[model samples]
Target: MSLKSFGAKIFAKNIRKKIDKWASKPEATQKKVFQELIDKAKDTKFGKDHDFKNIKSYADFSKKVPVRDYEELRFYVDKMVAGEEDVLWPGKPLYYAKTSGTTSGAKYIPLTKDSMPSHINAARNAILCYIAETGNAKFVDGKMIFLQGSPEMEEKNGVKLGRLSGIVAHYVPSYLQKNRMPSWETNCIDDWETKVDAIVEETRNENMSVISGIPSWVQMYFEKLQQKTGKKVGELFPNFDLFIYGGVNYEPYRSKFENLIGRKVDSIELYPASEGFFAFQDKQTEKGMLLQLDSGMFYEFIKADEFFDENPKRLTVGEVEMGVNYVMLVSSNAGLWAYNIGDTVQFTSTNPYRVMVSGRIKHFISAFGEHVIAKEVEEAMQEATAATKARISEFTVAPQITPKNEELPYHEWFIEFEKEPEDLAKFSKTLDESLQKQNSYYFDLIEGKILQPLKISRVPENGFQQYMKSIGKLGGQNKLPRLANDRKIAEVLEKIIKA
Candidate 1:
C-alpha cells in the first residue's frame, strides 16, 4: 500500500473505535446529547420564548415545543436571514443550505459552526467506517471525484447561500483537494450539462479511484466517461473501488450502476439532508443504516400513519419500535426546534437503532384510499424489473383521479428505460401484481373495482431530465419526485412526452 493509503487506514481504525464506543450504549449517549443541546440553547431567543429554561426532561421539552414543518418555522428563519442576532441559535449562522420549497421559491436552512460538524463529520465517518469494515483503504490514495453543485455561493443578507453539497465542496480538506478531480472552475458551472462536459474533459485521464454523488448524476458522469474512453468505467479507472450515494433509494438503479462499472464495487448509503447528516451504513452485514446518535441532533419520531391525527403520538429514540414507519422530527444545534424534515423512515433493527428511508410524508397516492408509499413503489419496480429482464432509467407514479366519470381511478406510472423489456405488457402487469402484494389496501381496491389496474406510460429516454430542466431544477440535489399526491407532475410529464 502507498503511504497515503496506510495513513487513511490508520485514521479509519480510530473512527471505528469511536463508533464502537458510541454504539455500545446508544440510549445513554443520545440522552446526554439531548441534554447538552438543551443546555446550550436555553439562553437564545427561541429558548426564552419557549421557556426552555425549565424544560428538564423529554416530556417537558415535547410539551413546550410543538412539532413544526418548514413553513411553520419560516417566521424565525426570516428573522435570521434579516441579520437578527440570537433569533434561533446563539448567533447568526455561518451559512444557509437552500432547498426546494412548496409555495415559496426556496428554503434557507441555517448551518452554524456548531452544526457544520454534524454534516462534515458524519460524511467523513461514513467513508472511514466503510474502510474500517471492509479493510479497503487503497481508494484514498488516488483521485476521488465528487460530482456536486457549484461551490460559488451567493450572498443573501450577509449569509452564504448554496446547496449542502456546494457548501461541503468549499470545506474539502487541503490535502485531499490535490487528489480531487474536476477543477473548481468546472465545478462552479451553473448549468449541469455544461458542467458535466467540463468535468469529463478534465478528469477523463485522471487517476480516479472513488466517486461520490447522487446516483442519477453519477450515472450521467459514467455514461460520459464511457463515451469518451469507449470503455466501461472500471476499464477507464482500473483502481476505482467505491461509490457513495444518497438522496434516493439505490435499489432501482443498483443493477444499472453495476452494468456501467462492469463489476461490483463497494457502495455506501447515506441518509443526509439539508437539515443534518442523520445516518450511514456502518456494517456490511446490516441492511439498514445505523443512526447517528452522537451527532448534535436530538431525534423524535411520529407514527407516519397517524401523523394527520390532531394528537399524534410522538416517540423518542427509546420509544421507537422495529418495522414501524415514522416521520422524523429533529431538534438540532442548528437552531431547529422540533422540526419535521418531512421524510419517513422505518426501523429495521432497534438494538443499535438502524433505519431505512421509507418515503416523503407528502409524496404518496391515496386518491382512492389505496395509500402507497415510495418504499412500496421502489420494491415493486425492483421486482418487476427482475421479473421482466428490464432496466429502468427513471420512473414516477401519480394518481389518475381526473379521468372521465366512466373511467375508474388508478395510479399512472411515467417511466424512462435504458433497456426495454421483451414483453412490456408483462412488465406492467408484474409491477401491478407486486404492488398489490405489498399493499393490502391497494389489492382490496382492485378487487372491489374501486380502482383500475395501474397504467404505464413509457417516456422518451430523457423525458424526466427534460421535465426537471424545464422547471429550473436540473441538478445539484434536485430529484424527481417518485410519487405525488396528485397529477400535477404527471401532467407536466405528459406535456414533455407530447412535445
Candidate 2:
C-alpha cells in the first residue's frame, strides 16, 4: 500500500473508535452538549434576553427561547451583521454563510469559531469511517474532486461571507490537500458552465478516485466529461471507487449516476447544513446517517404533522421514536437557541440515533388535506422506476387545481427521463399505487373520487437543465424541490419544457 493509503487507514481506525464511543451513549452525549451550549452562552446578549441563567431544563429552555426561522430571527441577525460582539455567541461570528432564503433575498448564517469544526470534522470523519469499514483507503492516494462554489469571500464587519460550500472549500483538510483537484483557478471561476468545462479539461486524463457534490450538479459534470471523451466516467477514471454526496437524496438519481459511471461505487451520505453538521453515513450497510451526538449542537424534534398546530409536543434525543417524521430544531454553540432549521427527518435507528431526512417542513402538498411530503413522492417514483425499468433524469410534483379538461383537480407530475420507459401507462399506474400505499390521506382522497389519479407530464431531455439555467441556478449546490405545495414551479416548467 502507498504511504498515504496506510496513513488513512490508521487515522480512520482512531476516528471510528471515537465515533463509536459517543454514538453508543447518544442521549447522555446530547445532554452534555445541551448543557455546554447553555453554559457557554449564558452571558451572551441572547442568553440575557431569554433568561438563560434561570433555565434549568428543557421545559425552562423552551419557555424562554421560542423557535425561530431565519426571518423570525433576522432582528438579532441584523444586529450581528453590523458588527456587534457578544450578541449571540461569546464573540463576533467567524464567518457568515450566505444562502438564498425563502422571502428574504439573502440569509447570512453565522459560523462561530467553536461551531466551524463541527462542519469540518464531521465531513472528514465520514470519509475516515468509510475507509475504516471497507478497509479500502486507496482512494486517499488518488485525485479527489468536489464540485463546489467559488471559495472567494467578501467581508462584512470583518467576518468572511460566502456560500456555505464555498466557505467549506477554504478548510480542506491538510492530509487530502494534495489529493484534491480541479486547481484553484478553475474552482474560482464564477460561471458554472465555464468552470465545469475547465474541470473536464484539467481532470479528463487524470485519475479521479473520489467525486463529491450535490447529485444534480455532479450529474452535469459527469455528462460534460462523457460528452468530451465519449466514455463512461468509470472508464475515464478507473480508479474512481468512492462517491460522497449531500444536499439532496441520491436514490432518485442513483440509476442515472450508475448509467453514467457504468458501475457502482461505494457511497457516503451526509446531512450537513449551515446550521450544523447533523449526521453522516458511517456504515456502508446502514439505512441512515449516524447522528452527531457530541457535536456542539443540541437537537429537538417536533412531529411534522403537529408543527403547524399550536403547542406541538417537542422531543429531545431520548424521546424521538423510529419512523416518525419530525421537524428538526437546533440550539448550537453558534448561539442559535431553539432554532427551526426547516428540514424534516425520520429516525431510522433509535438505538444510536441514525436518521433519514424525510422532507422539508415547508415543501409539502396539503392542498386537499392529503398532506403529501417529498419522501412519499420520491419513494413512489423510486418504486415506479424499479418496477418499469425507467431511468429518470429528474422530476417534481405540484397540485393541478384547475385541470385543462375541467376534470377533478389532481396532482400533476413533471418527469424528465434519461431513458424513456417502454410503458409510460404502467409506470404512471405503479407510481399512483406506491403513493397510495404510503399516504393514507392521498389514498382516501383517490378512493372517494375527491381527487383524480396523479398524471405525468413528460419533460423532454435536458428540460430540467433549461429550467435551472433560466432561473440562474443551473449548477453548484442548488437543487429543485422534489415536490411543491403550489403550481409556481410547474408554471415555470410549463413554459420551459423542451419543445
Off by over 4 Å in 2: none
TM-score on alpha carbons, each prediction? 0.98, 0.99
Best by TM-score: 2
Clash count per candidate: 0, 0
Q: Could you tell me the lDDT of residue 50 within candidate 2? A: 89
lDDT of 1 by residue, 234-275 (tens): 888899999899999989998888889999988899999989
**Candidate 2 lDDT for residue 498:** 39
Q: What CA RMSD would candidate 1 show?
A: 1.3
Which 10 residues in a row give candidate 2 its minimum summed lDDT?
490-499
Q: What is the C-alpha lDDT of each candidate?
A: 0.89, 0.91
lDDT of candidate 2 over 1-499, digit per residue (tens):
9998898899999999999999999878988898888888989888899888998888898888888898988988999999999888999999999988879889999999999999999999999999899999888889999999888999998899998888998899777788888898889999989999999999999989999999998998999999999999999999999999999989999999999999999899999999999999999988999999898999999999999887888889889899999999999988787899999999999877899999999999999999899889999989999988899889999999888777999999999999888799999999999999999999999999999999999888889888888888888878899898999889888987735
Provide C-alpha RMSD values for all models, in order.
Answer: 1.3, 0.9
Best of the candidates, lDDT: 2
